[model samples]
Target: RVRFRDPAGATRTGEWTDAIECDGRSYDPAAVEVLPPCEPTKVVCVGRNYVAHADERGADVPDRPLLFLKPPNAVAGHGATVTLPTGVAGNRIEHEVELGAVVGERCRDVDPAEATGVLAGYTVVNDLSNRDDQRRETNWVRGKAFDGAAPMGPVLATPEEVPDDATVECRVDGEIRQRASREQMVFSVPELVSEVSRFLTLEPGDVIATGTPEGVGPVKDGDRLELTVDGVGTLQHTVRA
Candidate 1:
């Protein structure tokens, strides 16, 4: 359920019981160093995948999946600090919690029916956005894809762990902000994988961010973001000015 660094600083794998067991040893979770569950080659994210999110943004629903990318450098581990870029406090840097599908095997031109077969597991992703740059520039490099923009982990769940429709939620300092079920997504995981693979190849350890629900708003420095995907564990991060 979790992969972490032991007190000795060696990487180990284990499942969550009441406590975590790794290297055939059980230890208090608070003593372990939690790492980002996956080292993705690339992070492939969808946009406006939820109908209500699209409606909130005053954008039309897309007939097909709208894809974007965040480089591997953007990933931050669980309990990490997400540094907000300077001068965006009033400009609207926001947090989006989404279901992240981790690719298991390399494949191309895979059908929707076979998409889940290529998945290694699922995790929670905080899709942080800088709205000012996003709206001012056509390319999202500065707006959506930036260092530490994607804080993930806490745990990576096997496909069997997630139900047909997992509920996703985002909270700021213990208050709920975003909430939705996977069923609310305009496109399903199968469709996204099938369609994305049609254009590019997917390799092992690549992450697909399924997108977030409505209720996305601004997050300030010192704000604590907790994103949960029900079956998948919660990812916690603090914003730093």
Candidate 2:
């Protein structure tokens, strides 16, 4: 599913195929302003879920999933430009590509085997971070949950549409920065869902970013980022200095 604003200055949501069809009108995708596929109240993110990513950060792999939260204000849609915080000296913002799962219903203490049943679909996410603030704080709120920190969407594909071992990649200014398969994850999607629900109730539209792969790096001003998850779609956004 996709959400966009038509040329007529009206908002519309519909299936995205060759074009966007809404109210008997066929609108060109390029002609409309695309919005995030879902309005997630909070984004539950898994940290160090990829072994190589953990190693690169000089942290040991956790025995269990490390979780964090991103409030709604941090959500940004595809094609949006993310502005880096400049007030703080030595603020280095980096990008981490992740596969985001949109919750389909409200549930808690879900079984791992039935996790997919509560999922609305999947989309691409860029877990932008401020390395300086992250290293200084324990909660990482300023580092990970800044405004427009999570640039997601372009489209949301149903669970059946995505593969069990889909590929996720991030390209910066047309150069490949991170690339890996879901198979490399230390915890599977179902396991992460089950584990997360154990702590809090997941409501409809909540997102779970299932961690990022290795090769994460810094982004300069005016850098274009393309975050892609196989079977979903690519999320394109740019960074402002």
What lDDT does the true structure give each of the candidates? 0.89, 0.93
Candidate 1: pairs in clash:
none
RMSD of 2: 1.0
* TM-score of structure candidate 2: 0.97
lDDT of each residue in 1-241, candidate 1, tens digit only:
6878888898887887779887678988888877888888889999999999999999988888999999998898888898888765356898999999988999899899999999998999999999988988888988988889888888889999998778999999999999889989999998998888898799887899998899999988799999999788889989987
True-structure Cα RMSD, model 1: 1.3
Choose the strongest candidate by lDDT: 2
RMSD of each: 1.3, 1.0
Of candidate 1, the 10-residue stretch with the lowest lDDT total is 82-91
